[model samples]
Target: MTKGNLAIVLHAHLPYVRSEEPGSLEEDWFFQALVECYLPLLETLEEASTAKDQTPKITIGLSPTLLSLLEDQVLKNRFEEWVSIRLELLNKLETNCTAAALDLKGHLKRQLKSWKSCKGDLIGRFKKLQTLEIIDILTCAATHGYLPLLRENPEAVRAQLKTAVREHQRLFTNAPLGIWLPECAYYEGLDDLMSESGLRYAVLDGHGLLNADPRPRYGLYAPICTRRGVAFFGRDSESTLPVWSARDGYPGNPNYREFHRDLGWDLSIENLKKIGIKEKRPLGIKLFKISSQNTSLEDKQEYDPQAAKESVEKDAESYLKDRKKQLIKLEKSMKIEPLLIAPFDAELFGHWWFEGPKFLSHLFIKAKREGVKLITLKDALQLTPQIQLCNPSPSSWGQGGFHNYWLDKSNAWIVHEWSKAGREMVSICSGGLIEESNIKIIKQAGRELLLSQSSDWSFILKAETTTELARERINLHLKRFWILINAIKDNKNITEKIIDEIEKEDCIFPLISPIDWKKKI
Candidate 1:
């Protein structure tokens, strides 16, 4: 038994990115995450658990949209093709390569090998991990909808909860025990809906607990239960900062992979164009190290895989020692074994910070040796079942630590359209138009509505990188939804062409039912 416990959570998400268009940028995001992050994390777990009789515990929140992509037969095959392209590019680079490019070539080969090894059965591997008690899976709100902004319509929020539970059950064959409230966005009574959906616990930012009614005695070190019986685990930033911060985190060390210095931007356009890669953008083959924080892209040093491994080992040991000392300090005066919850975006590891998955694998093994247990949120609660009852404040882990990143002037106009479509969805579904007679159209409308409400579109609008595409996505989904809704209302003949296109384009939640959108009032 360890004196302290750490729960490291990875929230893996991307909005519905499948498209009818070939080489779609949105779909590229999905493929990149799978290649760079998801596969590596899975491989780490697979290798770490090779020893019989010991299961490594990791909590991951897989969003419905992300799971939808992973299960898409078309996208699954395309991801293999995506890997092949990078391997071909590296093969071409091998002839005139520097030592740095040679090392990156080796990395690409291993990624390709792993992709083949999985044989399009990644989800089965995840299920195996859970069955082995090595990974505890959590679901996110359907469509990755930011719940606080959708508070005006409780029915809409309830629909998100219902769909998550339903979709998770379809894939995992069991209801999930926790949810990553999209962006950790929480409101006054969201937990009641979660409890009703049969979830046992959820996580929030530290401030969400600090401001709870009567305050918490353990601050972010303990779970607090709402009157609704749902437990809220606050994120301990102290556990996160050493690895996640961009400016000072261990990932920024001089030997780690340089994220921005890709050969896609450095090579000639004709070379990339031969491989179907577009001009002036990354093709997921980076070859440089972040030699210094202020170094220019062209001057960056070569990435040394051996040196980076050393850095990961040293950093992981330092982190485990720090936590052990922290627990010793807290135990001196505190009554219970302190729990530290460190939650981070899963993409940060192999995608953004190339050494992230390796760091985590090391952290887990080291913690076990140092007498600090790596427990899932579920296991931690079982160890310490006592909870403090309080009403958590309305909070979000967004910009400004509230809802400004979602609700500010840059994207405020979206709420009106989302609310209007949401109210109409509940009304139309409740009005018996959801019958088996017109169920296909109703389900498509529900799908379009969910896609339009994705928080990524609004976040993109604010980020200004793809504002045009973001606006078009939101408006197009809303437009398809209204066309379906009004056509059903008018009893008009809908063209087969339109229906076919929508069925292909908005293909997510394969088992979603019209009843999932029912008004809960």
Candidate 2:
């Protein structure tokens, strides 16, 4: 048997961003993710799974909103066009570069070729992996609603949980046994709802387990069961730091591609427009490396793809060696088998850090050779026969390790709107509005309310990266919700034009009932 078990969990999520107009900036979030993150990650895993590769175990959380976006035909088609245009953009730069950009240009050509090979079917590839048991797929809250903040509105919490499970079933045709709570945030009493949703396990930060009621005897090395019987796995920070940390992580290496310095930002709007990309946005063509820290964007050196590729192999081997050493030390110190749970945002791989997907592929190969067993959280529990029951403290992986990221002065007003919307929505559906003539508008109203409750808007508000758009999203949904509620209550006509528009834009949860909001407990 291996000395210890290592569970690598990747949480893939993005708030629903659909657009009817051409060239909306927010729409690029989905397309960029598809071309960069989702497609490459899927291809890497497919290649890894082709033979009897028992070492490539993983658990991935697919939030309902992201799953819906991946399954949408419109987005799929747009992704094909987006990558095609960018490939043309790269073709122009291949010969015109200042010798500094040759490697960057060649790198993009290879990436686009891989994208073409994928043919834009990321979700189906993910499903195929699940069927083969190569990876375990986990569910997340509907719209990724921040659950701790919504605890007061239990019905809203239940709705998020219920809707997520339902959607997961609809997609994979099997209920998920694990979940990645939005933000890895956990508060007391959430497990009860998970039990109801049929989720057997979830992952949280280390402090969540360290501060548990019984003070877990094995600490982060083992799983803990809540009073509600749901299993909670705590993330291992030591295992996570090498990849996620900016100061010390692989992403900050001078050889890796820099995330922020995109050529799109340097190009003229007129030049960009001529290329069919009208918006002055990230064209997913970054041409430089981190180079040297304290170096400005203009001062950075050109990226050499060959060097970065070599670094990926070395880094993956170093990471595997370190984890094996740590696991051995931990197992000896504890006098028992230790489990290392490393969970990270899936976007970090190919989207933020260009070599990320390749790093993962190499890690699996290196771990297998070094005898470091790769396992999922479910597999960990099966090995450890005894689990201690405990109550975790209220915590998150956010900036202060609390709810402050979603509740600070910048976004505090969102909590009030969310609570009010929940109360009002419950009143409408439970008050007999579900009768024959008006259920359509009421259901649409619930969709708006649910979308507004998304944790992404509040996060964007606090980050201030796109505040106006975030504010507009809140306003748009709240206004539409009230319009439907008032019309139905006053026995007035619900406008078809309004219904038609929102259904086109914010259409998620094709089967959500407004009554999911009525639970008082």
Candidate 3:
């Protein structure tokens, strides 16, 4: 008998990293995520759908920026070439790691076949799954902007939500009822804005609900509803930690493939350049197993695909067993049915944890046998007649359970830049007559401004990984924003070529409106 519900929310997002250069780091980021994470995830879900006893259901949040990237024809074509090149490189592997290389090559070949079967239409495939009720899709903030930080200019926050809704509708043909707030970050009044945008629900860190105005009667097991009518689900730490923590989770198992040790870093730079790579960086060709947590990369043993497969199956069984026990205990003590919300970054599944996708597939198969009900967030809402009403606390999923991670010394500088650009955007959209000729310029400026507000930049700065690229992206957007805003302010006769050039590079949110930044009365 089913004891309780388990809602697994995977928030999928990537910064707008489109690049014209084939071997650019930005391009590599998108391609690697496509090959290692997204494609594998889709394949896993597709495979799980074939099971007759249980239907796999989960919540996946696709940010507007990532949706745009997925729909881009240029990126789609490049992904095929990217896979071909990797396959070629894998075949040329003449080393002690040949077995591992061959294993990865086979996986890639299957993924490539899957890509072909879908005609490289990942977005359509995901949409079809949603149509089949296998998954509930959520929209994220436009460009994955940190909503709480943008709250200084309320209109800025509104623009982010509105643009996301519009873009999601354009692609998915309906407004999203829920959102995976960027970083699972929430502030005191964010629900009002979400309600205004017609969003009905969102997921927040456990504390956001735990520390509510009046403590929830059922705590994190049940969702809380704000006066504004938006429902907020809190993350269940018990359900998340075992999968999210590398040190303590199933992902750290010694049999799993080691993510950090890759063939890209091992190959000579001269040889890499021969394949069009200009520098030494991860090329997503990992072949080492985490023999031990303490083992150095060089000392790691060669990955055995068979051993990793066994580990995934074993770990999935253990995870479901734990959930079953927890749910049964909670059902006995709780007044209402218990819900364990396990929210994670979607990329973690297949990218960071090599066997992540297979693990999920295993979860679906074992969940039925284990008597643990796996349902989507949308389905969880219906479990209770009415949600507990409370004002959630200001919180984020970042370290310290607050905004400090994104607002710390490393990234605090960018906040002012975001605020300044936001205010200017509002001024331009509010004050202007919006000539037919300049509407294009104003819309482009709005795109640039929104791009600058991406939380990824602040995240990168704080993490100190790819800081230079983060800084460059933030400045690039701000610089272009100022140029476009100035042209509108000065009423300069800007050439069509100039505007065309800017649009060609950072083109996203084709349906974005400049008026979204207009100050609310």
What digit string (tens of lDDT, one per residue) describes model 1 on residues 232-310?
9998888899888978889889999999988778889888677776656777788789999999999998788888999
Tens-place lDDT per residue, model 2, 272-341, is 8887667677877887889977899988777777889999999999888899998988887776688999
Residue 62 of model 2 has an lDDT of 94
Backbone clash pairs for candidate 1 read none
lDDT tens digits by residue: candidate 3, 276-342: 9998999999989999999999999998889999989999999998999999899998878899999
Clash pairs detected, candidate 2: none
- Model 2 residue runs over 4 Å out of place are 52-54, 94-119
Model 3 pairs in collision: none
Residue 384 error, candidate 1, Å:
1.4
- The best candidate by TM-score is 3
- Give the alpha-carbon lDDT of every model: 0.85, 0.84, 0.91
* TM-scores of the models, in the order given: 0.96, 0.95, 0.98
TM for candidate 2 is 0.95
Clashes of each: 0, 0, 0
